[model samples]
Target: MKVLLYAEAKRLLSRSGIGIALKHQMEALKRVNVDFTLAIDDDYDLAHINTVGPGARFVANSCRSKNIPIIWHVHTTAEDIRNSFLLSNIYSKYAKFALRKIYSKADFLVFPTRYTMNIVRKYGVKVEGEVVSNGVDTQFFKKNEEKARQFRRKYGLTGPIVLCVALPFKRKGIHDFVDVAKRLSQCHFVWIGSKGLASLLPRDVREILRNPPSNVLFPGFMPQEELVGAYSAADVFFFPSYEENEGIVVLEALSCECPVLVRDIPVYEDWLQDGVNCLKGKTNTDFEKAIEKLISDKNFANELGKMARKVALERDLTIIGEKLKRIYEEVLEKHGKKDE
Candidate 1:
């Protein structure tokens, strides 16, 4: 069997955590190399998929045209109603219509979370879909005790370390992170992304934004191994997205045995339980309190981290890949029977 790896913007995902995921796909493709031919492109035969990386739907219809089974994978819902990325008729007319094309034409749909699946459902895109959690390599996520210590020593951090990795979009609640950092002066705060907020903030916000007394670090665009080490070094992982379709980074952190602290959202309960796998907080105060509770009580944090590792072990590549494999086999078999 031959498979096409078509993505419009692979470069956007390079070297970031998202890139790490793309790397895993590349390696798995290597293992399954004999069974398939992975070709990268958006423009091809009508059956060719115009993939926007792993989960974007642009390539779905392209593949469907050739009677190929297309996987409509959409990574981001990307609804910026507050900022308004689309004009009135433009969105309801061509843009959404184009998305509908990808949805209706595909044989199946794949999403990272139920929240993202609901987004497509809300748009009235009727398609068969499943939530396949992104996979993390167990070997890479193991406890690097020595390496973690060395990373902490190099950074001159001895106390608790809080890590939040994400694009600096307004919706990511970067301001809230900064506030949480300022509220806790004894701890060190780390930011791992730089997609939004290049512009200077107002002076008052600057007080919180400014890198303080050797406590805040903005180590930009790290390689995959280094990032895994960073997660190992962290005592707490903060995922403060105002909206998320099951944050993939959360899985990565859990694999590293770092206890995650996320804003209370519907998706969290679907995958993660409060106090069972993580500590979920709803308000800004709630988040800060959760951070304090985690940092102040080391034993609780350690227990939570172990539970997180357990979660990751269950959801790692060994498991998630099976889901993908089954899906692919079903797709191929359906077509084979059709041909018969």
Candidate 2:
């Protein structure tokens, strides 16, 4: 059973979550021994697309004509896309309409979380769909003391480290992160993301990026290897994202045994427990308290980190690969194509 896997605007979205998810999916498929091709082939049994653009629309139409099942991975919704860049909110209405139309063409829609599924349904996406997390590679993100030391040395960072891995967007709580940095002047705060797309950012967000707090460091776009080291070195992973489909970095931090403190968003309801594997905060005050608690209670923080690692193991790529294989088999079976 050969599959055609495609992601629209692959080059443009290289630093984005959508692109990262697509790359992970490809790796998972490879690990599961799923036969796939980047380009469309006449003998392909299915076409799995991960974006809604002109090229994606063409692929969907072609698949429909050939009676090949099309699976659409829902990575972003109009709601989540809002506040992500300059004029993103203004374009959200059109994005929703386009999403509804494109999703209707799919034989099935794959949502990374139930929260995302609910969002799409609320926006009138009436299509068959299922939830599947974009799992992390535990082996790659595992804690390494030496690597962590190197990462810390490179940045000349000392004291407790507070980290957040996200794009430079206001909706990601970048402003809130700055506020937290100001409130906790003693802790070294590092935000690993891109600032090169400043033109796409709103004026306020761009201004904040240009002038961050002295304690805050925006070590823009680290490669995965270095990122894993940062994850390991960080004392706490503080993510105050106002919105998210499913924050993949949370899983990576957990995989590296880093205690995480995230915003209390619907996306994390199923996977995160306030005092179990992670700490959830609603307001800046709550976030400050959570960070202070983690900092003061090393034993409690370590316990949570251990539990978080357990959670990461459950969502490892090997396990996710099995889930994907099952989904592929089921989709093919429904289309009268035997898995064998």
Report lDDT (CA) for all predictions.
0.67, 0.90
Candidate 1 wrongly placed segments (more than 4 Å):
15-18, 29-38, 41-62, 80-98, 195-214, 336-340
Q: Could you tell me how far off, in angstroms, the CA of residue 38 lies in candidate 2 after the best superposition?
A: 1.1
- The residue pairs in collision within model 1 are 47-63, 50-59, 55-73, 55-74
Give me the runs in candidate 2 sitting further than 4 Å from their true place: 41-43
- Write the residue-wise lDDT of candidate 1 on 1-340 in tens digits: 4556444556754644345555555455455441343353523221223243334453554454556676655654544222212132244344444566556666777776787788778777887778887667777777687778877887788888999887554456677787788788888988787533444333433454454445667765565667787788998898887776667678888988888999888777677989988998878789888988988898999899999888888767766666766666666676662211
Cα RMSDs of all predictions?
A: 4.4, 1.2
TM-score of each: 0.83, 0.97
What range of 10 consecutive residues in model 2 has the weakest lDDT sum? Answer: 35-44
